[model samples]
Target chain A: NAGVTQTPKFQVLKTGQSMTLQCAQDMNHNSMYWYRQDPGMGLRLIYYSASEGTTDKGEVPNGYNVSRSTTEDFPLRLLSAAPSQTSVYFCASSERLTVYGYTFGSGTRLTVV
Target chain B: DQQVKQNSPSLSVQEGRISILNCDYTNSMFDYFLWYKKYPAEGPTFLISISSIKDKNEDGRFTVFLNKSAKHLSLHIVPSQPGDSAVYFCAASDTMNYGGSQGNLIFGKGTKLSVKP
Candidate 1:
């Protein structure tokens, strides 16, 4: 089974453009997170959902929005793509309060010009 | 301020040798630490971990050592192999504060490890 799956593995967008990165998990994890990996920056959390219909901001929540409409799906939306937003995005999920670590998606490479 | 830090940006070791990757964290509340390895275009995968209560944990050829007093942790790979070449990241979580449910991890800038054949 696909633990976690992310779509549009690669995308390039012009500044001010908008797009959504989709994430789905078959593990039925109640918590999902969006993170951006940049050179020398590690992974910075953008947004996260503890469960369906609940979302919270992380370290870098600006310029992004997230919704957990279902236990299996949590999509990250880029309102206005900026050059600063160009980075590799990862989606991860885990059971609520699980310390076993998160299962991450392969990743989506987004470039904002 | 960055809570987790991997001072070395990259490390190189020969096959059949030992590879040690170091990590430091500033937050004293971080009790659980983990290591993840990643290849190009792929997501990071959990490698090993250590808790504050333990000084060391081992699994096969890989071992993780945690020095809570120093706020430092390290991953040791003995008899390194070419297949071990990848970026290694050190992550920490405050199970006390964030709880097991939140599980918000703080990651360090990764150290790219290369093993020469």
Candidate 2:
């Protein structure tokens, strides 16, 4: 079973370009999160949704936005990609609010030139 | 500022030896701490965790120790094997707020561990 799937595993975009990072999970989890991993910076939250139709900005949400229309799909959009946005993006989900931990996707490696 | 810090950027341990990775946090409200392991090109996976109420928690060969007063935590892997080589990340959350939901984990930069055979 595919726990979580992210599309465009690798991508290189010119500065000022726009792109969407797709995340889907088969676990039917209630919560979904978007995070970007940079050098010397762990996974910093970009955006998150506790449930469908409810999204919240995270620590670093300036250049990104997220929409969770369905429980299984949560997509992240970069309106104007910049070189500073180059980083590996990860998508994660948890079954509940417990400490069981989150199931993560393989991740999308994005590079803004 | 980094709320959670993994001071060691990397560590090397001989096979069959103990691998101890350390983490420190500045947030006093953080009560739940966890360790995650990640291989190249993959996402981090949960390894072990300890709550503020518990000083230590063990699962098989992996153990997590929490020192609340010191705001420190460590993950110990006994009899380290070659397969244990990877980047380890420390994450903590304040469960009191929103019941630990809303994606409240604050993570450290991570420490890459190498188990040499």
Top DockQ prediction, candidate number = 2
B80 Cα displacement, candidate 2 (Å): 0.5
Candidate 1, B15-102: lDDT as tens digits: 9999999999998888899999999988889899888999999999999999888999999999899999999999999887673334
The DockQ-based CAPRI class assigned to model 1 is medium
Model 2's alpha-carbon lDDT is: 0.91
lDDT of each: 0.91, 0.91
Please provide, for model 2 over A1-113, each residue's C-alpha lDDT reduced to its tens digit, 9 standing for 90 to 100: 76999998999999999999999999989988999999999989888888889888888999898898999999999999999999999999998644456999999999999
Worst 10 residues of 1 chain B by lDDT: B95-104
lDDT of 2 at B19: 98
Candidate 1 deviant stretches above 4 angstroms = B99-103
**Candidate 1 lDDT, A69-108, residue by residue in tens:** 7999999999999999999999999888444668999999
Name the DockQ score for candidate 1: 0.59
